[model samples]
Target: MSMRLQGRKAVVTGAASGIGAAVAARLAADGAQVFTADIQGEVDFVADLTGTDANTRLVAKANARMGGLDIVVPCAGISTFHPLEGHDDAYFQRVLDVNLIAVFRLVREAAAHLKAHGAGRIVTIGSTTSTYGDEGLCAYSASKHAVLGLTKSIAAELGPFGVTATCVQPGAIDTPMTAPAFDQMPEYRTFWEGKAPLRRLGKPEDIADVVAFLCSEDARFVSGHGLWVDGGAMVRH
Candidate 1:
């Protein structure tokens, strides 16, 4: 395997499963020392990222694990899909808390350490829903759109310090995150396959490969870009 991430130290949240878990494995394969934290011991540290104390503990564990930090990937998120009529304020808050706000909190805590290292990378997982809206995914779409904003702002703010941030907005990758839709609304497969140029649901490796590039020297000049791994679904839809 290529050692593109050798000597790099990174932390990935929501790493117990789904994209976060795939990213953790990919980063490790690329030679980065990855500290993965979730609500349970599915990977590395077992800490929930929704609270202040837990966020602090996650970062501390990452620092201790790698001896320093050079990369931060905030992949923890939840989707609260509801129609406007049924959606409540409390539900919206919880969605924002997990998907958008928690990511910001993690970055705020990790910023100083990343800045100190220089050439640090931040890759946040966004969604194609942000680019193309659906009836039931209002909250999720809005939250992910916020991630794009965070990515661009961070890239602009931290460029002078040799740090960069980018968002990887993916389409329907066949992960646990999408399993419910696949099982409950099997019709989604037809729409996705018919419109996407690739004619297949994305695999975790499809996105993981791009993340690897973003964290490597090859993407040194690239920042503030929301690279899509949607197999042209965004364009066709």
Candidate 2:
């Protein structure tokens, strides 16, 4: 509405639905030309982020489409429910590949372009589990925890170049990714709702709004921080 991001170019992953979709739409609405990537639905680029060359190709395509890059939002992720005793190496690896490793690769591929732009922004989507543990989300939690570390590391390396890196941690968002959890544990919905001070579930736009701020000029001095968009869920935790 403010056109705060006018002339800015952004690439948002997992943009077909949920928080990613909301974020992409918000950035575009804010006057940034957005190039989106996803394995499904209509998007500018379609590729699995876990693929070996997917990150490279995605960044190349975004740069080509937008002529340059100023913002990067790595919002792709996956989660599975399994106790620690049942946690297998394959499951752990798969979660990390999509949630953590892919993020690193995406940022690595886009780092130079972002640096060149100056005031470049990298906003990663982490989770409430990033700061704490979840009942059946060992691998997901670990990957999210590592996301904070990755963002902070990137901030350290990119801050001098006028590029900022930050993470937004959401709690119990209503999205396709959490649909399975809601189905398997129906009570989870009510439980999360009660845990939040807002006494309601979080919408994709709830997280997207914070992301918009972190990517805007208003947050120029913010970096290496994980902003919680959890509707006070973290406070209860």
Candidate 3:
């Protein structure tokens, strides 16, 4: 409906499902030509972002295919529940590698093209845990916290070059990754519901809309911020 991004080209990672898939669809609906990447899916690139080269190549391939890149939304992330006592190196490292390292690498790889374009937008996916530290989510919280810092640094460094960077810190959304937990532990869902004044959990579309806004000219002046799309849950907290 809104053709604000009609001529814009975007690369969205983690497009296989959940928030990532929603973001890809929203960007396309906003009229941007979207190139999607994921570890497994019918996407533009099936990349295991945990690998260094894959992160780099995903950007290059998107830029080449789209002729130019104006927006980049790195939405790939993994979360694991582990107590600090026995979090295990493998689990912690895997979470960091997927959530933080891959995001950093993608931004690094895409910086040149974005800078060259002189008006690039980078919208990263952070989580409410980006600021709040919750038990059993040490690695996820840590990585998301780092993401907020990373996005701020990116904005400061790239603002002069006409590039804007921001992070979206979403609350509990009913996505594939979280649905099972909500279903298995109804109390968990009820707790979140009670925490929000809106009395409802978020939908992937809630996050996708904010991301699309950040990538458009409507948000041209908005940079270096962590937007919490949590349906006022943080306020109640």
Candidate 4:
């Protein structure tokens, strides 16, 4: 509806479904040309970002497909439950690979193009657990915290280049990434629903709306921050 992002070129990962899909759609609706990648499904490019060359290749492909990169949103993430005891190193590393390293490599690859453009936006995804630890989400929480830190550093370094970096921390979003946990522990759904003053689980589009504003000139002066799109759960919790 609003052509706020007209002529902007962007890259979005994990765009086949869930939050990534919502973000890509929102950016497109705002008039940005979006190139999307996912591990599976029908997207512009299929990339397993956890692999060594995939992240770099995805960035190059997106840049080529879109013409120039002005926005970067890395939304691909995975989480599996395991309490501290006997949580294998391999499992923890996998979470880090998907959630943290993927973003890092992609952002690193996109940095030059964004800086060249002189008005770039980088919106990374974080989680409510970014600031604290959850029982079985140790790896997820750690990776998210590190993502927040990485976004902060990016903002500080890129602000002078007219680039903005921010993180969106969503709380208890009802997405495919979260469905397994909520399904296995139905109580989580009830608790999160009751915790928020809004009394609802988040929708992917809710976070997407904020991301659109951040990518647009409306939020030109906002950067280096983490926004909680949690339906007010953080305040209530």
TM-score, one value per model: 0.96, 0.98, 0.98, 0.98
The residue-by-residue lDDT of candidate 4 on 1-237, one tens digit each, is 799999999899999999999999999999999999999998999969988888788878888787889999999999888999999999999999999999999999999999999999999999988876689889999999999999999999999999999999999899998899899999989999999999999999999999999999999999998999999888865
Q: CA lDDT of each candidate?
A: 0.86, 0.93, 0.92, 0.93
Error of 1 at 69 (Å): 0.4
Off by more than 4 A, model 1: none
lDDT string, candidate 2, 1-237, tens digits:
789999999999999999999999999999999999998889999888999999999999889877999999999999879899978999999999999999999999999999999899999999888899888899999999999999999999999999999999999899998888888888999999999999988999999889989999999999997888888988877
Task: Provide the lowest-lDDT 10-residue window in model 1.
Answer: 40-49
Per-residue lDDT tens digits for candidate 3, residues 1-237, read 598888999999999999999999999999999999999988999979989699778888888898998898999998756789988989999999999999999999989889998999999999999999888999999999999999999999999999999999999898988887898889999999989888999999999999999999999999998999998999966
C-alpha RMSD in Å of predicted model 3 compared with the true structure:
0.8
- Which residue pairs come into collision in candidate 2? none
Off by over 4 Å in 3: none
Could you give me the TM-score of model 3 versus the true structure? Answer: 0.98
Consecutive 10-residue window with the lowest summed lDDT within model 3: 74-83
**lDDT for model 4, on a 0 to 1 scale?**
0.93
Q: Is candidate 3 or 4 superior in lDDT?
A: 4
